[model samples]
Target: MDQSLKSPGQSALEDAFHAMFELTRTKPAPTLAERLDRLARLRALIANNESRFEKVISADFGHRCATETAIAETLLVLGEIKHAAKHLKKWMTPQRVPTALQFLPAKNRLIPQPLGVVGIIAPWNYPLQLTLAPAVGAIAAGNRVMIKPSELVPRFSALLKEVISTKFDATEIVVTGIEDDISQAFASLPFDHLIFTGSTRVGRLVAEAAGRNLTPITLELGGKSPAIVDRSADLGEAAERIAYAKLVNAGQTCIAPDYALVPEASVQDFAEKVQASMRRMFGTDPANKDYTSIVSDRHYQRLESLVTDAAAKGARIVQAAKPDDPAWKTKRKFPPTIVIGVTPDMTIMQEEIFGPLLPILGYKDATEPVSYINRHGRPLALYWFGKDNATRDEVLARTVSGGVTVNDCLFHFTQINQPMGGIGASGTGAYHGEWGFNNLSKLKPVFYRSPFNRLADLYPPYGAKISRLEKMLRFMS
Candidate 1:
């Protein structure tokens, strides 16, 4: 149906689409100044609502730390906005290219233009950052944006909607709440581009829906990312970093270290250090206020099931908290856990464990881990810990992952200059920094024909002259 003739009672999805379409028709390409203005507004909105955003997101999670919110969500987006604002003018400028000798009087240039409407669908984990960071890129490219945040985090979702609504015009940016069937319609809309960040299962469905509209999409899906501990590594420091990365947000992160490949002889030592690190970070059983709880009861049960299935399959389950600790009884808090002797038949190894569960797989050599990683789908991130440059180089060259962090974990995602994304099953396409601006924009090529051109010499009357010109052109370079 023609959007212009849609019914009065059309779904809210239609309203958002029509609003952005009408607005784009009025202002096809925003000026650089206009783009900067939008980014500035986004930064200010987060700056002004830092405390409230922390409070609401904590309410969404059982209890998220205000500092974590500030660092992961608020500060991250703020830094992105600043980076974009500083370089957007350069990104938007037309780039010149060399014209071929055959077209001596012609000039070539590439123009970057917005792709009308960009739709961003974010997940429950890192709700604020996932939703807004992409918006920062789309806005930098001067596209009208519509964001759909996960409904599971209702408090953050509602607050995000409220914040965007209060600070932005409906035609410029719209935030939609999770309204069941209406969301299906949102994905199927003929958007210029779409970005979905979540599970690989849902990513397939979203891709299928967008395919019907011939809409280009960017998928930021999750996978079982791994951390490799080499023979020469500082085992204690590796355990500390890995534990912090896994336990943050209760391991409800897309790039969290899902498992580790430790040297066979040092597996027990590494595991012990990881337990001590967990104790120091969250006290006994993670009862401290700093540790975040599972986002929902359903997820809590799912994590429990992963642990139970693994244990039933002969995996040795080590509890960081005291046995039968009351912390696990809570509807939200799932204590830190580490699994050993895990096999491929177990459920934990088969899927991306999006909770506080870590599996330590023993490896005899560096190539063993590389071969193991290659056997499965590509991970979103990979971590290597060791001072042996030769071993690190071999691991780096032998394995393929979306991104890598050397001697540490999860911090590779902090570099705004580097593009952050997944590969193959983990995800498709990339974004962040200049990569994002280019992803959302269409880099169109324009050629100028000089009036004094001699192309008429080889026109339709082509015979000997045309043959000579073609042959000469082939060898001209």
Candidate 2:
């Protein structure tokens, strides 16, 4: 990495990292007051520009739902900032731990220290929330932050950069350019910690680059998260909730239910209910502002292909809009589609469907869904819907996912106290509220030795006295 041959984006990134690294060395731990001030500035930045952010994000997506942006992006970030600001003092305090009886006179404490500069690589979906929420935790832990917003949402990314520049110093918190060169170089920087939110395919690249620098990462990747509809579950209730979750961002959500698993007898009924629910919520019009369009033409075409592939493979394609409807294609609005009788070989079932398309699969018994999920890579989120406590408990215990909502979808992520992350193929590491604070902060343990402790007597000079102590220790154990 010679400076002379480096791209402008790489050079700028190196400069930013060096400046922030130097600042961390000079003033590593910011005071409580300083941290609170930073949080306040972030709060004001979001509050003052809420409307503008909504508009820019919509422009980026062609037609992003305004209410969805407010709820999923702006509101979530504001809530995270408020949570971090309120409980920061308690979160930052050192904790006491019990000492072993062998070292009874010593004291043990765990201190939380900042991890210096944190880098966040955000995706275009929910750009504001995904980018700033992790920064909230890093800032709360008193660390400098650098964010690389998605290139897909150029308007939103540029607006974020300009507004962030106005409120904070570059070294304190900066938004990097979303150039291709910048994106490629961002993960390679030797950050103290990195947070990436995107598909599993790109998460691997980011993780590999970060691994070279031994930088810790919190990856929020997507997967084929499933919604299990138990036989005892209320079909109407489950359908409405899952439908809302699937269509919220036009199914661009990472944790959105990728497919549904219903009992064999109820498969057709559940599919109809879900389709009806989708129509009721978003309606049959592509021009409906309440409905959001796919982020780009490429993404829209991909969704169309998934539906086409499923249909060609003998899977039922239920849609509110016809496949060749020019209105939907021109507007980049993907018709809410439900795929029935999807087989494992279908491309739609083989990959994560980050669109409004939902595949409805039927299971023979309670154990079939669990086994099916286990056979594939673990999902980022899992949804179980049923009133039977025994069945719900069994499903929860048998399945291993990043997180779970017992009878709902996407609600677990909103709980600030809970860790929002995935496992294995879904993601690696967790963050949100105290979980985020602790993950970004190093919990260094401090042990205080008392002058009167007798443990030193057993060091070296082995003899009868040490032998007698060992015998006593064995007896105690």
TM-score of each: 0.95, 0.98
What lDDT does model 2 reach?
0.93
Model 1, 1-477: lDDT tens per residue?
Answer: 676665443466787788898777777699999899999889989999889888888888878867778888888999999999999999999999999988878999999999989999999889889999999999999999988889888888888889889889988898886877556777888899999999999999999999999999999998999999999899999999999999888899999999999998888999999989988887654557777888887888888888999999999888865323565556377778999889999999999999889999998876899999999999999999999999999988988888999989899888999998999999987889899999999999999998887788778877888898888888987
In order of listing, the candidates' clash counts read 0, 0
The C-alpha stretches of model 1 lying farther than 4 A from their native spots are 1-10, 322-324
RMSD of each: 2.2, 1.0
Which candidate leads the pack in TM-score? 2
lDDT of each: 0.88, 0.93
The 10-residue segment with the lowest total lDDT in model 1: 322-331
- lDDT, model 2, position 336: 92
Candidate 2: worst-modelled 10 consecutive residues by lDDT? 322-331
TM-score of model 2 (CA atoms): 0.98
Which candidate has the highest lDDT of all? 2
